[model samples]
Target: MMFVIFISFTLSSITIINGVHFRGGMITWEPVSSVTNASPNITLLIHQRYAWSRSHIPCTQTNIFNRDLIGDYSFNPIVCLSSSTQCNSADYNSQRISSDVYCTDINLILGISSSSRSQSLSLRNNTKLVLAFKGNDSWLSLTYGSPAGEGWSLPVFIDLTLRPGIGINHSPTSTMPLRINIPIGILTSIEIPMSDNNVNDVIKCRWAKSAGTINGLSVDECAGACHSYTLPSTVQLRTFTKNRCQLNVTLPYVGYYIVALQIEDFSSNSSTIALSSVPLQFVLYGFDSYNTRTTCMTPPRITNMSPFPTSNGGNISVTVNGQYYGVIVAQTGCVNDTETYIANFITKSPSAMKTSSFPYAQNNTSQYSMELQWTPTIDQLGSTLTFCAIAIDVNDYSSDPFCVNFIVGPEITTTTDTTSTVTVTTTVTTSTLMIMTTSTTSTVVATTTATTSISTTETTTITTSQVVTAITSALSSDDGRILALGLGLGLPLILLISLLA
Candidate 1:
């Protein structure tokens, strides 16, 4: 009896130390270089992003800005589980990419720290493999549910076999906040935006399985969080078609539900094999506003303003090696001012992107804003980078994710021409014609014509050359004006000018 009690105590201690830190995370990869005859090997850049409890990881703003690494946690390398033997080599199998995760951001209010890291690997062409990151048992306890002692795992499938028409395969990307709060007893729909470089491929989403084999790789996708919540009889859990993953749910009780989903890309709707499988997991907290007397409390919304020219899941273009600046604005809908205020703005951005300090007030109203600044390097040319953000109120109610794609390339300029013809018949009278043209880029061209009308028709041609000159002059005068204006008025006006320019 003494021996059994001692063994049990030691096992319990190990569980407490190793099981409670992981919240959620995802794994994605992109081709580092194009496949060519000279270089038969395909190089891929693998990205891993995870969130953990701040109490365990201990991350701060300084750590995030400095790109510090969380060195305490044990390394859990992502390994290959595919049946193919080519990708199962020692170098490609379970090599530890990094000692620890890089601290990218931290939320003190929620006590969650976000980490992201990337590593490069090379593999031969036509290699099909499935990679997964599996962890030991124990997830953070839920508010209204029992402790989840089951382990967690994330897997992504990679297919190197070129498509029939398309050249290479690129995996789909997705983003969301670590946690979201929804009102109980009400139907709500959440849309998870999915973007893929292979625009022709069909993207779909489904609930993750606790144990399954994807493309001959057997593993547990999501352990304790697999189908953890029950939805209404009439509501479907998700609707995935046309690069969209929408979850229509209505929680009956006030508690936390873990949503685990895998996004996969197929050649077509009828294709049986998936080109890639990316995992996305997050938490949804249900709260009751009626019980707390919060009569009118609604989630915040991203405003459709100047910088944000398009709505969620829209595309914004940026130039290579050019500075890009923008702002995200959100507003709450609580009538009773004391009910809630904007608490935080959680974001998932590229490693080099920088954001302003969060929880900033916007003129005492319930509106809040966060500034984003990034300069795409020359190496990032022709790449589509994604940035996603969400706003959380003091009551923990979160808005829908607002994600945008930044296409990097040369600046795209649009020009519109306006031509007008004026015919005046005057006998022995001289008339002066003044034509002014304005362009969308704020370029103005003025033309003056003095004509002597003696029963003759005069035709004057106004070409777009004048508009080009005006635009050139404006650009020359504002060569370094983006930097100056950005420093003075912050990034909002600068991004507006970037969009207009």
Candidate 2:
């Protein structure tokens, strides 16, 4: 006996029809399309089972339906479009089902129970197909399998691609303040933007006093306080997580300052300091002062020291003269009070020497003098000494060091000696009228010495000798006295003696 059976499935606007036939304890099915406009490329899978189970068995049990049922009657219920030839290979032969054959491998089914058998059958949007069951069973006792299979069938899986997203929420170039005024000791903040999807990303910034140019503004035009007078100093900017950055700065002087800010992400480790990129150049105004001068704080200066080149002698006294002996300012406790100024003599060469603090008097409103003593040790003799004197105000504000050069020399010692010496000589000649001559000679020597000691002691001895020749010569007391007087009074003689001695 033969009977006709109808199976209908509706998904969205697509519907599938199958005709089931039973003959001689065997089942067969044919698919039909209800809609004519369905695309042949579109695939469909169907899974069906009884809504209620008599035994209350879970719909997810994998073992309830066996692949091998009865003799050559294969239980593999998967199906797919005839175009997918692999669908025809599924049978009791037990070759692990290929996603190519099973439509379920591609995730095409909906609403399946555990006991249901799986079949992969691809149908055009509104196509029909005939399927057959291997064994004879009441339609009420029959359960359907997932059109594709239990899980994501095989090869193609829904893939979601993710892309990196990072952007600056606030444009540093457009939104950043180009100019700002910060008072002395006052803290100021500037905001940086971090607009990105990554919540875990971090942002960082570093600042330099000289930012060549950012956007169209020259960084040189934005000079203030420290940046105005010296090489650009770099400061780091910090932020934790909020994607917002704040730069806190304290202005030191009343002048224009230009700073270049560099931004980077912690994760990317990239910075915007490249020439192609533009960073904000901030023009910050500092505190207002009565005497508006573009100068950094000056340390004490030692202008002059008396003597100009001091000697590094034992216990030598030195005098330092200079100005800015702690100029009174708003920072100091006592305004214009010179007494609060402290002058210290520092020895730079000999780093081990302690700083010498001395009192300084304002010789005039613009200059000052301070007296200090330096004693040189034996080792320091002949060694050049370098010294600087710095004045510090009560507020700990210090002036530039006034440096002095010193020459070390040995102490002077004097010794005196007086000496007297006399010499006598005689020669005689007898003349006979151009015929005969006779000659005689005699000599005498005397020495005297006297010594005077001062810081150094010395002993001196003197000796004299002389030779005389004439027509007639003899020793004379008068000559001796004359010689003595001449020897003592002669300027050339003393000079000669001094040179010879």
Candidate 3:
């Protein structure tokens, strides 16, 4: 009995130390400035994003908005772990960048939490380096793991080499949710949202590796959870495209599978070395009850509401120091209402952007909404920032990624021009007779005038014009006699004389 008790105590201690909290994470870097003249020396911003068990790393909405540090053991700084010359020295090996990851979001009910941190470092140009965050173990009991549990290792390859024409290189980014769920026995399509600043560069995706080096970095890309997906013999991938980062497959078994992939960018299709390599790790869950007898439940769809004019992938323009508001609405098509409902929202946004709490109530059935508010600062001017989101249901199924690109500052604008024209024609006539002449003489005069007006708002114009004429005539004695006879014959002569008087 004594020996058994000792063994039990030892097992409990081991479990506590391992903790099994890691979920998924990635690391990426970008140049601080677009200029490449600083060839030998350039500053880069390194960003890290990770998800963990909320039970292990607790966070609050307040902490997320305030960007407060997540108080946990994982807050330790990430260091260099590559065996290359850049990391061989004592100083380089010990080079610690604070992993001050702030709580980005928390879903206690789902037992998940996310955090992100970014730091800037000035390093030599045309150099290759690898940075990592290591942990004792990954999430508890992944579908494809040993009884002892697989360790958690996330390493990112940083290349500071400049492209031939594209001054500096920017790594590709993803907005895929950390977790996703699909119905069992049904084939589903998944497309990861990815983008790059260097539009000319070609991006590719591949499963993360456990052995060998990538881009000449001497380290395993993914530690233990490498090629961690275990598909049944009958199941085969229907379509897989590296350039688009898309896949179509069916998961027959009901279990959790890790999707560890590397997103790399190249100058062209034939380029051998990648400009930079970024890791995107997440989990895919298979469940049995996503479909019912009357109808087949599907993942929620993000509506193209106000501010978001286009459907899935679109772009919106904003200005610095101007407040921008956006609404994201999602709807599920499940006829059986009781089994599923929108639970939360997962987002990948720029720093300082704030998001409302999840599962906002709406009048429409099966509809959920969340609000995004942001005010771009002067520093972010002229930069195109990407924001991505996914609406998740209670069953862990998520909507297709809805990402919008925000073009910041005054680079893009809308201008309206209006023009109005007016013209007026006025004619004035005056007649005069001289008593000295025997014959009657008459003279007439006419005058003309013109005017123009112009008004502008940004750019506008208006115009105006006017004109006048004259005539003269002479009459003999016979004509005068005829006129007198006609006057005598006319009965209206008395009325005409009264008007003259």
Candidate 4:
């Protein structure tokens, strides 16, 4: 369906600033061609999606100055809807910027106003060539840079008056799109976005059965209340508000349904002044399936595992950042089994591996983070371990697995001492080495040496190869292996590391 707006040229010259008026978009063109053959399409790069106005509110001046706005002009003489409640309307509001902030939110204007070219365009160099049209007034402000009679002439500026046309923020002759899935037997409130036409005009909207294929279902037959229904009469009183004109409905069935809606503006006398018909449309959805494989249940994801290269042999705290990690869902009396969750850890051959979860650590619908504690045994030295976590919901559905890697080892440093006498000093930084294995075979490498000096005047290097061989042989004995295993068994330790860095 096509709707035409008639522009009238007989409106007053005063600016209307306190209320919503007409809503529309914009267009662009070249006013004057440059001598260098630069295409006059300065704003051709701007997409039409960026150049939209609802209730006379425009986008930010930065969007305009950057040539991101269409029509190349600002819509002034407009009031901003800054209230938290008024600015959240899905139709007139983008929900991207704060309405309370000036130039950060769009303005909604209607009716008509007459202003000079300078007033309409803000008279700035960036806005110099813009041509703005709204209500009954239109103006063109331009600057000519080409050589005239002799040298560069003064910049040319022109302003003109034009007829005012009525504009709708939303398409008046088309059906709005609605698509959503809702779980059955659950009380839910859905917000339907609609446009607020004018303050003097009250909008009345209603939904009726539409005959056609909608959401892959026909409205010719009723699928119980779940398959089809209409908004309660009181919904009009509960849904419409200043800057937010919408419809509210409670759907209590599980099936596809076709719904048609119509909105009309009424004057204070209760007479219809304008009409908008939403084309027939369908909203498709089904009852929520509590299976783990259902697409609605997003799997858990790991955002970050901090403190990479974790040091061994110390108290270490591990922080895991993840989404849909695990949430505690309060159970209802229903037997659907959709509210239970269990979080577990998996690792390969961990030594002295102990686990503890933070009670009520974190919970959200699908976003969560958990803190875990563990200490590696001496036997796990120099070994890198990856810990994988998975969450299971009440319906036996398991989320995707997330893992983090950590290396177990202590910080090592070396030092040497030199004296007047010729001496060679060797040091084994740590005296104890613990090797852990399920097998019976064990290998040992040890260096035992004392600080000794040669009496000869000339520099002499003494070799302790015999002493090292003796130590290695001694450590290989059964008694030596028993001692090493005893030292390896110790309390769980934690490595303090920051994963965010």
Best by TM-score: 1
Instruction: Identify the runs in model 3 with alpha carbons over 4 angstroms from their true place.
Output: 1-17, 35-38, 71-75, 88-95, 147-149, 228-242, 290-296, 305-310, 316-324, 334-341, 351-354, 373-384, 394-397, 407-501
Q: What TM-score should be assigned to candidate 2?
A: 0.22
Candidate 2 C-alpha lDDT tens digits along 1-501:
111111211001001112111001111111222222323322222212111111221222122211111111122332332223423332212222211110000001212111111222333232222222121221111111111111101010000111234221111111232233344554555555433223454455444333343333333211221223321233336654555666666655555443434433334335343211112333343544323232223334444445443322212332221111121111222335444443332122221122222344554533445544344444444443444343443323344334444455665544554342222331111110111223222233222222211121122233222122221233344245435544454445457669999
Q: Rank the candidates by TM-score, best first.
A: 1, 3, 4, 2
Q: Ten residues in a row with the worst lDDT in model 4?
A: 150-159
Error of 4 at 418 (Å): 62
Stretches off by above 4 angstroms in model 1 are 1-17, 36-39, 71-74, 89-91, 94-96, 144-149, 228-235, 304-326, 334-340, 352-358, 372-383, 406-501
Model number with the top lDDT: 1
Q: Global lDDT of each model?
A: 0.63, 0.28, 0.61, 0.27
Count of backbone collisions in candidate 3? 8
What does candidate 4's lDDT look like per residue over 182-292, in tens digits? 443444444443433334445554443324222232332111111123222323323253324343444344543223343333443354433222222223233444433
State candidate 4's TM-score: 0.23
> Model 3: how far is 425 from its true place, Å?
48
Q: Point out the higher-scoring one by lDDT: 3 or 4.
A: 3
Deviation in Å, model 3, residue 382 alpha carbon: 5.9
Tens-place lDDT digits, model 3, residues 1-501: 000000000000011245666677777778777545555566677777777777666666676666666523534556676665666532344446655566766665567767765666666666577776666655545654442336656677776666666766788877677777777778777877677878777788876677647666566666656664334443322213345777566776787766667788888888768777778877777877654332435667777646647666678888887888888888875734754677888776655677886678578767878888877767567667667787877666677777888889763445554343212111221111122322122222222121221222121142211110111112233234334433443435446557989
Error of 3 at 29 (Å): 1.5
Q: In lDDT terms, how accurate is model 1?
A: 0.63
